[model samples]
Target chain A: MNDKKTTHFGFQEVPVEEKAERVAEVFHSVAAKYDVMNDLMSGGIHRLWKRFTIEASGVRAGHKVLDIAGGTGDLSYQFAKLVGSNGQVVLADINASMLGVGRDRLTDRGIAGNINFAQCDAQFLPFPDNTFDCITIAFGLRNVTDKDMALRSMLRVLKPGGRLLVLEFSKPQSEILSKIYDTYSFKVLPFMGKLVTNDAESYRYLAESIRMHPDQQTLKEMMDTAGFVRTEFHNMTGGIVALHKGIKP
Target chain B: MALFMTSTLTIAALASAEKMLNAALRYDPATRIGLAQLEGKILAVQITAPALQFFIMPMDDELRLMGNWDGDVDTRITGSLLALAQLSQTEIHNLKDSGVTVMGDLSLLADLQRLVKNLDIDWEEMLSQFTGDIVGHQTAQMIRAKFGWAKDRAQSAQRLTSEFLTEELKALPSKPELEDFYRQVDDLRLAVDRAAARVETIINRKNIKEKSNP
Candidate 1:
């Protein structure tokens, strides 16, 4: 490991070792309210974002699926039904609180006999190579310390011809819309966080982290660099969110 | 031993039902219109309580019972046998809240529901195929007369009840009475509006005098 390695904890520069702990703190602080906050903040369009991801996933029965950083298991629950009894879906998240909430939610919905839970960082997936037919990380990649390493790890685990779908907040396509989105994110989002979860700082960090993340083209190039072929992205809701898909050759 | 017996019985019952329905669909062109939409699809019917599995395969102008599949199901319809009975004769729109549950692709489920509702069997035409034309025609005429009489009786009974309620018992108001009631309410509203206008005019005049004096 490089002794002087540094990464971003939202807008703040921190040691690579410290970024994961800081991100854990943010997620742990907002874990209970994560789902509700997503609804309130995105006006329930986050469901559509995740739905589009599932549709584009082309997942089928008897296929093995991995949902990394799958907080609350929104994608996993649907994938469980799509994959049915013969298939397996693993919901992996680094934060224990998020993983607990996800496990409980899936159990309560009676989505079992097919789903498994794992608590592990995205950069080091605990599975055999070429094991999964599909892997998805929804709205969770931006928070990782080394996104390049995470992409490489995902590529390493995906089977030949298997696909990876990354659903994330991206730079809005138009300037006027971007300004409006920025205003809403910086002003209304924090205010909502304070009102709902009483954690404005965490939400502020969320906004900053989204801004600090790479743009759509940059991310596709990064995936390409990580050995994912034919990488493409679909921008949704005026590019406030994007679903990037790539296939392993 | 019990499980094997039950499975055997289910398969037998499904085969019989499929034979009966397919025979009916063979003679009834109206029912085929909706079932045609479900061609090349397997609709799994799961009857609860005893928990029986049956499959309906719509293929080339016919619906056949392809028995119990343990593999991936395309569309599944689950309910009690009683619910299935109700589904055959009743429109799905009518059975929306009637204790029957359907889960599958929306379009496929809709086609199946439509097929169930539109399955109007013409027994006369079916009987003509087996029996001679004269006997079939006479039998059909007799049946139609009976049905027509029943329908006329029902309509007459409904009309008698309505006439009794309106003319004899006076349970509902006459048209004249209803019209008078509406006119009185409209007059009362107009009177209130006039009174409010007079009050506003007086207030405005007083305000104008007060402003001029000041």
Candidate 2:
């Protein structure tokens, strides 16, 4: 009788249309303390993960890069420097609060003249077709309501021979590591979130969302299904986080 | 697991090295300016013994070291770690036989060598930022004087050890004695070649006479 489509927002099932708003509320709540929480939760290993993504991106001078869901402008800051004066970097995020925080942070750091900010959803990118040479969504894709749709949207915006890098949590390779990671995610992360950001529920949702997201092979297959070629993945931190890369043909 | 460990470790190592080098370079403004001039150029260092390679890209007065780079590099040097270290400290032209193979832009390597040679860090000024000016100045002076004394002592000890080995212990050849031995060996090699040539001529003559008589 109530068949209006449903999707997983963390462990609970919700209407497809409400997932985006709910996810936005979570980001809005954590936008101010996002960077601090990231550093604390991952013990600064996220920086190395982003560095690896930057190396794999192959972005040089005079290239257009889009940092989708680029909260806090971490990747955008590096991309702006790498692209030089002639290039452009657009930091796009769905939540206005995260975008505002990222914009203010980057502007305060004097990272202007080659960077722009866009408040747009990943599922329906507002850019023209075949625009960006490289696109990256770090730790943000799992929060997307429709990942397949977002991947196709990214593919559409990428130029022929452009690349898309997805840095997110994935299944661990070893059993023991998986057990430890599970315990940390479900227990330690929420506790830290409560201590730091005073929002345990958002961190709990984060853990659940990462678990609900596709595994490495499944995500690579998803990219293949979304009309991307040369789809491959590199697992970092014993596969607790995987950087999946796909190139547009 | 191996890939994960290797990549994480390599990235961590590169990040730390880059940070330390940049921190040092910050104290040496001349080197930083020189580095800025070499922006957009990439240098690839291939260490053969460990079978490792990394890329160094200079940008914005700092060096960016990466574990993996897929773009075209301006210069590449391949050798063992020791050979590469020697190449960095010595003149690039003088190290032609140092077992380090350099490819691509030779001028870039030369410029980099020049920058390294001219690096003069103001240790006093750098320390002043942390410890007050007087303490920093005294500490720097002490370090400089100690370094100078250590250099003199190291050279004297090296000479004394060489003398003990060659003259006192008779365990190794001295420089002049080694040169004389080399000269004698060369002369003996030439004499042996002349004798062989004369023997060959005599054998040829005997062969010719035997052929005519037969």
Candidate 3:
């Protein structure tokens, strides 16, 4: 028998092998409708959140950068412009549906040759070890089945001094803010989902997934355990999302 | 022969990709094959959108949908927002019987209304086709457009935790006077950490200092 036990999909547990495909299906179902849903759900603050992440990234001209799980390539487009002709940015995603959307969006935006697309998984990246300068996975890590293994894979691929930036939804800090957030996400967010995508289950999955994801501190520790030295996190928007940055020593 | 084999493999790969897109969108049989074919090249979205709500909201908490009064979001808000809006009083009451109460103070609703208006969103046009529990059609379209760029970008951001200081991450500053940015990443990381630590300390939160290189 296959030694690997099954894991949960939502509340009910399922076989591990099926997770990636299921996740892919989830993205596919919402791929064309993904961006719109994001706005209604987040109330449009997600843009600034990303701008903050980009600024914090400190990627400069001629610096090669990679945006993994770059759904529609928003960051990649910006990075390409920042990197200029001498630099390169790869808009990579494991979901072909997302990657297709990203590639088209980037091309439409008049992004030049510096940007490219790669359909690859997070845990098993398809590139030479130590090939990239900076690697970032925003909001995407939580969707992966084995996050620890994913972090370790990232460490292996990073050069000795390469930095990793992990940006994702995290636990809020203040009680008042938490309460307001609770009312919004649980009450308003899925309602927005139902009103918009016409698929409530997917948005519910998204919320549960965020809640299930490791918090900023836990992710920082995970970074350290995965071999990143000097782990730190910036709790943006009062810990709603955190940018965990660390380096390979 | 090897080159031929490699090129052939690439061709096969492309063909399979074509096959996958065909399979993925097949569920919506009414969707035009042309639309399905175009879904193949998956381009970056070219949305001429206004400011995002996450920015407008006081915090990310605004994104929470379902949950209790305790502040942690309940999960039902994910796919059920618009459907709830469409629900009649009796339907809402029936839903309440099932333990889901979506109603809230009018101020929050007003906030959402103002935000939609400020963005000049075409709600009526957008929401007409929106079916199911995800949201109104217009709401879903906007959500996908707005967050698609960000969520996708944020999820896939990987950094060179070890070699950020190396050439792979380093931009060539050939002429004198340009800064060597990667060398400064470590210092920047420290600066950020110290700032975060200071905030925690100032607030009397737990000792969440930088993890020293053990």
TM-score of each: 0.58, 0.79, 0.53
Tens digits of per-residue lDDT, candidate 1, B72-122, equal: 567788886545645644445644765667777646766766775445555
Q: TM for chain B in all models? A: 0.49, 0.53, 0.18
Model 1: fnat (fraction of native contacts): 0.00
* Residue B124 error, candidate 1, Å: 38
Off by over 4 Å in 2: B1-6, B117-214
TM-score-based ranking, best first? 2, 1, 3
**Please, what are the lDDT tens digits per residue for candidate 2 over residues B1-214?**
2222237767876787677668777788988899999999999888785566778898888889888776798999899755664455456666567888889998888887777654555656643433457865876676567556867888999999999999999999999999999999999999999999999999999999999999
Of 1 and 2, the candidate ranking higher by lDDT: 2
Residue ranges of candidate 3 with Cα displaced over 4 Å: A1-4, B1-214
Please give the TM-score that candidate 3 achieves against the real structure.
Answer: 0.53
Error of 2 at A243 (Å): 0.8
lDDT of 1 by residue, A1-249 (tens): 557988888888899999999999999999999999999999877866775676567676789999999999999997897676889999999999999999999999999999999999999998999999999999999999899999999999999999999999999999999999999999999999999899999999999999999999999999999999988887777789888989999
User: Candidate 3, residues B64-122: lDDT per residue as tens digits?
Assistant: 11000111111212123333323211122244433224333334333333332223233
The numbered model that scores best in lDDT is: 2
- TM-score between predicted and true chain B, model 2: 0.53
Residue pairs whose backbone atoms clash in candidate 2? none
Reference-based lDDT, each prediction: 0.80, 0.88, 0.61
